[model samples]
Target chain A: MSAALKLVDAPRRSVALEVRGVSHAFDLGGKHLPVLDNIDLSVAPGEFVALLGPSGCGKSTLLRLVAGLEQPDVGALLEDGAPITAPDPSRILVFQDPTLFPWRTVWKNVAVGLEARGLLPAHKQRVADALSLVRLEAFAQAYPHQLSGGMAQRAALARALVNDPHLLLLDEPLGKLDSLTRLAMQNELVSLWQKVGFTALLVTHDVEEALLLADRVIVLSDRPARIVTEFLIDKPRPRRRDDADLVHLRQTILATLGPVHD
Target chain B: MSDIAQGGAVRTVASVPIWRDGVAAAAAWFVAAIVTVATPDVVPWGSTPLWAEILTGGAVLLLVLSGTVQWLGRVGRVVVHYGPWLVALGVWFAVWEVVTAKTGWLPKPFFSPPQGLLHVYLVDTTRLGLCVLFSLRLWAYGFGSGVIAGFLVGVALGWSKRFAYWGMPILKLIGPVPATAWIPCTFFILPTTFSASVFLVALASGIPVAILTASGVGSVNRAFYDVARTLGASERFLVWRVAVPASLPHVFVGLFMGLYYSFAVLVVAEMLGAKYGLGWYLQFQTGYSAYANVYATLVIMALLTSGLVKLLFVTRDRVLSWQKGII
Candidate 1:
């Protein structure tokens, strides 16, 4: 608790992200299949933004480009004023599957970032702090296979947080979770964002998830994803699902997403 | 009153040692000693008195154990579990003695009585010991070098596309051919018979490990690489820390195959132009019609091979402990 309190006082060094005229496509067999088309977006430092889209709208592709894992066919991604060319410890992406290294204990998995950067010797305490942040200290010695679904995902979050990443790219990080765990984790994510104050970009198919967590929610069209609309969620913290304004926003976003096609 | 009576009966039963199997084993051994001492052999075999004395000793030991085994705890359980086998072994020995030595039904210079085997052990201890040492040294050198070279080749083939392209076809071509087939060429090509024998063993052991390890490394999930990369892992870290550890289960499979293959090739390799090995001893004894020595050596080979296989199993269980529930 003291460490978490100390983190609030530590100056936040979050960077503004800019995606300008970004377009990407995949070569499936002999044909070119476009995924993202001419996307222009800017995120303020320390802001919480969520991208809401259909199942295959290429929202995840945008996150990968920002992470510098893959380059866009056109245009550039900038971190502050500098171009993002390759993956750096300052930016971390968490996937829906948790993807914890199966061989390592939960503590070792969370310590991976620090170990990779050769900072583990100096910043060992950060691993404990990160585990405590996600309330996984008791399970630090457990393997990924031994953990429950929610605990595994929390361990994944702790793995990302150990690096003190300036930008967290969440590609449907909570998509695979059950509804009850999803609700609890959404609140935990809000608390984590408010406490640590890093710029977060989440991609989710659920409109309510976007409305509940994000400061700004961007919706994208299907296939070759283009920005359809953006909603500013100016609700206060601890927003209720039944809040009249959030309900109205959910209904509007759902209508725009078109009839539920399940 | 009835409950108290039942509890007293249970207590009395618990206090009494269970001695059924032990008594049976003791009787069998006693019979074996009686047969060895009372019946005259169709032909003379030395160590007959010593063998009878050994059987009587085993009978005495079993009779003593039946009265005391309950106090031995864990060891007592193991003794009880193997009690039936002990009885069967003693009966088997009595029958074997009657057929081979007492009746001469199995004939001489072909099948030896247990006493004949014991006589060979007493007379040829020095030569047998030397053969065991020589066989172990050749096995160690061939198996060690084969596994190391195979592991390196497997890693290279799995990791690099260019290496796989050049190496895969060659490996596939030679992998199915028996290593003994190369003896005809290796004997002429290599300067020494020792070198040729070592080459044959190495080839037999190395191929399976290479094939299995390469497949193991190749089949590792690609998502693991992606996860490691996003965590700021270097290429070296990805290979050593991630790829290598992930592929270990497959490598172990390869190791087990290699171990068995090496044993097979070692015996065959030793049979061809080998100076001092168990296989050579077998050939030399067969030439002299020393079937008793051959039987003794075969028993030694069985114990050695099975003991090595058990050692491999223990090592696998220790190294792959993390894979317990997952597998």
Candidate 2:
């Protein structure tokens, strides 16, 4: 028990995530701005869930709560039946921005999780492996600025994947890419998730994207976000973008995200 | 914008052989020779005929130096680039020598010929070398400690709100005041004049670094911290690894400010107390109306400061090489 905290490992450990009645608010100077209200979500192990919502609907806030970067004002987030009170290497978040440390090379950025945990010396090969996984072994020595937008995001993905995270919280990780790059990355992400089998909670506003990639899509209400509606995607792997089933589901999800009607 | 365009034109011209160095350097040598050999000293205010011979020798040396440009190393390349400036310098020197030593247009005791300054170097090399050594020691001790401590404090203030709450107001208050303003109190607090001088220099250089470092650390994109935190960074790792590296550019800016301030304070401190430094030499020479010595010391100071600044620039370029399109 005493030596448990200091033990070393970088092996994959996929786990379930549960968010129970989580509510959160921020104090901007003196004003109280509510962001999330009574959010209840449960993700099964190895599930890929896409969260779709209206703009400014606290999608990022909910992701932050799950990543353990912030504590909810009320309720709790659990991973594998254990409450998450603080950030751990087991659960990593990839932000909308690549957020690659500008001073470090792509390889070093990928090594950050292991370096932070003092496991870098033993697991150096993992950094190279992660870069190879993103097909960026050619760019290991390159800085973030030296890379294009698509490459930079790929490096960010490598940085997250290097940790062998149990849960990957993606906050619109592909939001800033051009259309062609976004399409390519969407496919790459689906394939990587399939291989790694980590439970994924992706936050995105693209309705078709959610339908194409996610096993389930959950929509949220506008600011002070609450779970509004959800859809179960039962299609087989490698679903086509122009497929009739996806087209119909995208329309439904878009309507749910569109303006409210009395 | 026009200046950059002009630089582009000049760069293209630089590819030519004669335009790069030969024509301009030859012109400089010709002008310098004409002024030195043809003219006679007027109303000799204790002027040396030997200086004219030396100027003639310099003209011949320039011709030889220009011819060997292709064979000379890095310094040779620099001479080629600044060939026009060298010609202008020759013209300026001719005007100076004629006005000061030959015609005596500028009055005595206030101005000097270039050779007059050179004479100080030739005669007083030992004393000047000692002063140089002392000044270097003082600067090394003061600026080195100041930068290291200030950087750590700046990181702390930027990283933790509680640290900032206690430190920021005090830093802001102390930052604006000149380092020399504390001279009276510094003398009483420190045991020796040397330590007192070091404190002043340290204070001068440390403040800018601290302020700039704080701002740099504090202004880092919060997303970086979020990512690092989720990767299981401890507080120590966040500070030393994340905050320090992110804030380095700002810290360097501070280091530059401190370097200048410490030098300014260093000179003033030497003027005040028991010291063998360039500042003391300047003060001592000025007291005796040795304008030549003062000018020589000023030249040394300029060269030293510029060299140090270049070194700092090289280090910054290496460390922040990841930053894009800065130059």
Candidate 3:
């Protein structure tokens, strides 16, 4: 109900994201370990895209690059045609863990971005709006430990949403959640994106999840990952997991990732 | 993890009925009072009418509290918790009185009855009061300045690698040496004995805090820093908001250690060249072998130090309330 939360009908200024020839590697005790291979992708403003890959296929590393927490060694990431150099409040990343500051309450955790930018005083109401957006208003003062897994993840989402980010990079944000919570949050995520209209790039290992949530799903190969295939899902909002088309897409995507051991 | 089970567990811890422990405590205290008044000392240690009165009064008060404490709400809960301790204290007091004054088993000058301690309290209240005030003043100044300096130095060492590179080796070298070991040098360096004593207390307290704080800050989860950075937090923000809060549990560990060290150094330092501290009073009384005064001062010192420790605990609970159940 707060002013910061735009109605679904209202126009939102989400940013266009461009990743060009991005390649990155980590040094593991003096040995070169490649994670992300040369990868190029672009997301339209207000679009929802999911990157699907095998576990440890550099999907999260790619999200980190897009978040500007780390720079890709080979290429540039841009937001709205401007090169991403440093982490900005406009581009927020939600990790697998809630990572809520244990010392802070849910409300305080959500206010971190605004507080860090010195804008909390002027926009305190946004924190409350963000909490309620994720249906966490009743637990605004509760500590992270007091919250259930789903509630804590919701609080983490609110922490990102409070900044009114243009692009949200989700690095398997619901990976640690139970299946029931994950399904509920997947619906919540879709509705939230529709309402806030942020350009979202989600990195997920679940093919069904990618198929269920994203307008477009980009599949990458195993470690030193490069884009292997892309799928365009024209399904309507509130798409069902069992829908024939989604089931077909899931199977095809899984097939492309090669045989699953599990 | 089940809330219902946890609630049941709590509900099962039933409060003692009829206040049996309280009654026992009152009975012991009454016996102590009777023995002090009715029996003559083996060697007429001192007239202790006031001590007898106090014991009688305490017994009567305990008896009354036993009857009425159930109606006192929160205070009653606290009384119930310490019921066993109260009973032990009463029994201990009676036994102590019998051995020292009634039988003279623990002979003169070497040991005194409880009332001999009480007699010291009644006669030398002014001197003890002055000593208490002076000791507290020195302790406050030393502990305050030392904690502050240590916290700053620790933060610097923790946050900046450059600072740690130069500071850590020096800290390792100096930290192990006893604060008292510097006493001779400190007296020569500082202009006054008071300053020297303060310096010793500060050194004893500061080193532990600095060492623990540095380690605490160093060991904070790196993920927290990453999370803060991605949230648009500045370098300063990361250090103050993320690093400091995350390291607080460790800092508190340091603080507790510092508190104990500070107290030990305070007593030792006061013994050196002070004019009017509890430590000074202890030394002065011992010189004359006024064992009664020394015993009374030791009791006061025990109460003061424990009171400070309890105060620190209260402060810690308030500051770290967020961490109540989590860690």
Candidate 4:
């Protein structure tokens, strides 16, 4: 635990992850299906960035490219000034399904990413600490089937954090939860980010969630998607949902997204 | 003052005694026995004595009585547990005895009394045991090989698009052909009778399993694979650790089906060519006109098939316990 604390003292001021003119497409029966178009973004060390868009706008695609799950057809993504060509444990992605191995209990599921990277033995304490941070200590031995949606997502978060990834990529991690659970998880995520001080890049369609959680929200255009707008939230930590300033920001984003009835 | 209580009690009185069904059944049996004895020559088969005829009638009556009791006592847990099984056994024995002994539809020399068959079973326990052991050995070898080979092939085909595209069509074309049809070719190609049996059973069983495993692999959530890829899992880890584990429920279903298929194919294979095993013993008994032994062998095969199927279910429960509600 103290060793992880050492990361906090390491200049806390360098660029953690960078996306430079990254673009991607899929092969659709000899036709190019453009997904993300020349997306360029950067997140400073310990900054929380959100890529917000409508469905099929390739917010998730951008996250995948940055995480190095899919190589961009053009340009490059870099982490700590190194060119990203393949996935690395330094950038871990938290998925919507929690995707915890059903056969493994909560503790084992959290430990898998570390184990996959061959870091479990040295980081076992860190894993436990992360699980405790998620308030899942009592459910450490419970199977994924036994967990509610929120609990499973918490375990997924714990798994990503156990590796002490420099960039924590979230692909709509709370999108599947009910409204009440989603709000609670949003608060938990922001608080955890504050405590851990890790750089985060979240992909979400919910404008409010993006406004509440991100330091900067990057909105993408529909299909052949590219960055369309960027908003910086200057509100202080633990901002309330009912905060007038936050509501104003949300309305501004909705306006940028276009007619709500349509 | 007590007159009202007495009137109410009379209104609430129970309908009949519990043994009323048994009593009625006994009377019906007596009538049937009288009719059967009076017309023995006209009976479908005349081998059974008048006394045996009466006993068979009584057994049928008892079966009906027990069935009625089970229906009436459906709410009672104890009756629910044991009643249906008792009635089923009684009915089965009665029908079997009547068909073979009281009816001449079957060849006379090839039929035996149920008591005579039971006596032969108890007396020749050693031979029966040996036959069971031989049949089980073949079953185990064939089923085990089929399941392992099917899962391996399934995973390979599932993990790679290239493999699936080329291999799946070929497997589909060949899978539907019955295993029994391969007996003649195997007889000449294989060195031993048992090897042929094993090979035929495995071939028959593995096709369905491979198809099932591939389908299972194809159905794994695309998101999970993306997550694995994003997490920096190697290609090997993705296939074995992620893809295979994800597709396990499908694999189990394939294995279960394979087990049953192998057992059926094993019997057919053994009967056709093998020198030893339950199927061979059945053939030998039929040729010698020992109809009771043939019936006994058939019963043994049924029991073995049921036991093996149960074992498959138990193994499935253990392996896929993770997938209880996921489907």
Candidate 5:
């Protein structure tokens, strides 16, 4: 698959987002409980990285820290050598649910981040281009209620893309989708990433999804989660579902997570 | 020529009615008239004439026939949907007229014969219209300000837990007190009677809006806020754009409830001090023993309340159309 895409020879840029020695916890009724402990990660510009772990492994916490939605108690997150203090338009997050505003049409939802940034005049064409890229041009004027689950997620994706974010954080964005739509969106996401060349950090419990999408997969341990292992996919864009090497990697990650004995 | 074509034509043709609905209506009217005429009242009937009885019976018949025609699809869809209700209303009017005219349980002229009340409705249109306008103006002013303030303060309290913790208790302490309870204080604090009424109405309505909006904001999915944060929405944007919209459905519920309270409070406030509102007219008519006018005012109040609610429903449908099939 890598040979077919021939992306390996393409010039790779420096890291667009970096996290070092980050830790986070919550004060639950006066008792502090740690969630993520001593995390370190880096994403080169145009790279696709996946954080795969069990339900309580705090992969989402790591993504939030990098997105500036939450602050790490111990360490720093940097974008282009500058520390990130708050959320910026250069980092966009997509969630498991579409989370499109119920009052807005698809076009308005896609344009919301730009509108929020007061960049409508400067980014109007970019918004339309992003929607077309997601193949949702026909649904631009349709409200969220009029869209199917798959279409709504695509709109959410378009909304994230329109800003041309330097870092894209996906927190189990496909977890709620049906198996077929999940597979289809996984392909769409990979192609979009390749074309747009934005760095991506996806968090998912599905080992296969991680292997199929990410250039690098980071596995995390249980509560007070820390990085347990990292595996490089070495596969290419438009990678096959049944690729022998990808299947092997999925099985390996599954075994590392837990036993399948019955 | 073909069996399928013949069957379709037959189905279409079979849909028409064989008899005119007016025949059935006339039969029902004839029976009612005969029964009323035959059953002579031992006591003197109050203010009801033979002509009025006949007219009321005919009106009932007309309503029933209209409903039947609608149900049979001789008319359009809206008529068919509202047909039974129209028929029920006609019957209700007929029964009320009969009971008031023939029965001794009600005082004379207090429950004015339906004809007299109807006459008041026709003749007093100007007075009724003015009262409706007065009430609606108060409603718009109070309800609008209440909803806006509720949403803003609610979002503020909802976003910060510390604010919610301190503010919620204060709100709870004050919110349970009815809006009408402040009427006495309003009279003293406010100089003008109309202004006082509006103040009472707004205060009464605003409390519920504030409480409901806060709770609505509190109930927003935390994950959604996280999404907004990641998208780089500023605190102001998060509250106005994300939190407010997300909590709108619940906020609407509060607005509706507030509208109801506003109407009730407005009437009370007006009756206590104002000189020109519907409540004032109601009190004046009752004092003068103008039974017909009193009933007319009561009818007007019912119409205004229901009409305001219907307007809200239409606005809600338009604004929240995106939530179709969701809630």
Candidate 6:
């Protein structure tokens, strides 16, 4: 908690990101499977946007491109008008799986980025605060196997958050949680976003989640995904689950998902 | 109803300390002591039948130990719990004595009584001690160098695609052949008999370790690497921290196999050329028809192997305790 407070007291350091004419495909053996069309998007500093898409759509591919893990076949990803040629600690991505190093305790997993960058000695307290932010300070010494699904996701979130990242790329982070935990995590995520104020681009299949937390939800079409539509939510904080407007928007979005392929 | 209640009260007498566990163990040893003293040797007593004295002495010791079992702490308590096995051991000794020495059902020239083996240990202590020290030194150097080289090569094979492509084919080709097959070439290739013996032991131990370690490293989930990479881990960190740690269970499996193979190779290699090892002592005793000394050396070798195996198990449990609940 002290580290987060100290970080807040320091000057803001979040950077803006821009994705221009980005298109991507993956090589499956000798075959090329096109996943992302030439899509353009931009995220402002401190903005929270959700990329909502169908299951096999190219939402995750787009996130990876912006993360610099994969380069787009065409066009480029720029952060603050500079090209992202490699993965940097300034931008971090949290995958659907917690992906916690099983041999490490929760504290060590959160400290991994700091240790890798050779900054552990100067910023040890930040690991504690990151765990505290996830309400898992009590479990800092515990292994990932000891934690429940929701707790593991929280630890993953803390791992990204500890970098004090300018841009946080979330790839369906809460997808594996039970429905009750999912609802609770949705609220926790919104509150954490409000507190830290990092620019978040969440890729999720949950329509209601986007409506509840995201400032703007960009829905993509099927495979070779193109941006089909976007909805801007201007709701007040503490939005209720049973809010009429949210239910109406959810119905409209579900209809847009189309009929099941099966 | 009152009569039944009185019957239940009478059943509590079964808890009497007179009928406790140590009683049976003590009784069995007493019977063994009496048998040892009374039995007449069918063959002329070699070296004064020292076993009867040892048996009497052992019975006395067990009685004292069992009496003070409470003072033995946790280990003593466990020993007392296994009192029945001790009782069985006493009975087995008596039966073996009656069959071999007393009745001569199994005669000498091939089999010797327990006293004959004990007499060898009592008279040849210094020479046997030297042989043990020499064997241990050779084993330590051979197994140590073997495992270290194998582990490094395994890591390279598992981590690098190019290395695996070239090295794996050779490893697979040479792996199935037994270490003893290399003895002829090793004797000519190395300068000394000891060096040749060491090479044999190293080859026997190193192959399994290298093969298993490569497979273990190769089978690690690719997702772990991706996770570490995104966490800003350098290439070196990914190989050492992620790949190596994740593949440890397999490495341990390799180590165990390698340990057994090395022990087998050690005995064979010592027999072929070494001058001062337990294997050499066994061969020398056999040539002199001193079967007693051969049996004594075999017992020593068995104990050494088991002790080393127990130590390895302890180390594994400590390092891999993270797999406790899951495994």
Top DockQ: which candidate number? 2
Q: TM-score rank, highest first? A: 3, 1, 6, 2, 5, 4
Task: Name the docking class for model 3.
Answer: medium
TM-score of each prediction = 0.94, 0.91, 0.94, 0.83, 0.84, 0.93
lDDT score for residue B199 of model 2:
87
Query: What DockQ does every candidate get?
Result: 0.68, 0.75, 0.66, 0.52, 0.59, 0.60
Candidate with the larger TM-score of 4 and 5: 5
Model 4 has a clash total of 3
Model 5 scores what on Cα lDDT? 0.77
List model 2 lDDT by residue over A72-129, tens digit each.
Answer: 9999899999999999878889988999999999999999999999989877878877
Report clash pairs, candidate 5.
none
Worst 10 residues of 6 chain B by lDDT: B10-19
lDDT of 2 by residue, B1-327 (tens): 454677654343333243335555556656655665566655343324455566666666667775667777898888777877777777788888778766789755778887677777878999999999999999999999888778888888888899999999999998899999999999989999999998888888888988999999999888888889999899888888998899888898998889889889999999898469999999999999988889889999999888988989999889888886534
lDDT value, residue B54 of candidate 5 = 64
Candidate 2: where are CA atoms >4 Å away? Answer: A1-12, A260-262, B1-27, B30-54, B71-76
The C-alpha stretches of model 3 lying farther than 4 A from their native spots are: A1-11, A260-262, B1-18
- Give stretches of model 5 more than 4 Å off: A1-15, A258-262, B1-75, B80-95, B102-107, B122-126, B160-166
iRMS, model 6 (angstroms):
1.2
Interface RMSD of 3: 0.9
Residues A1-262 of candidate 3: C-alpha lDDT, one tens digit per residue: 4443443434577789999999999999999999999999999998999999899989999988888888899998999999998888889999899999999999999999889989889888788778889999999988888999999999999998888788999989999999999999999999999888899999999888898899999999999999998999999989999999898877787788888513
CA-only RMSD, every prediction: 3.1, 6.6, 6.0, 5.9, 5.6, 4.1
Candidate 1 residue B132 C-alpha distance from true site, Å: 1.6
Off by over 4 Å in 4: A1-15, A121-125, A260-262, B1-80, B91-107
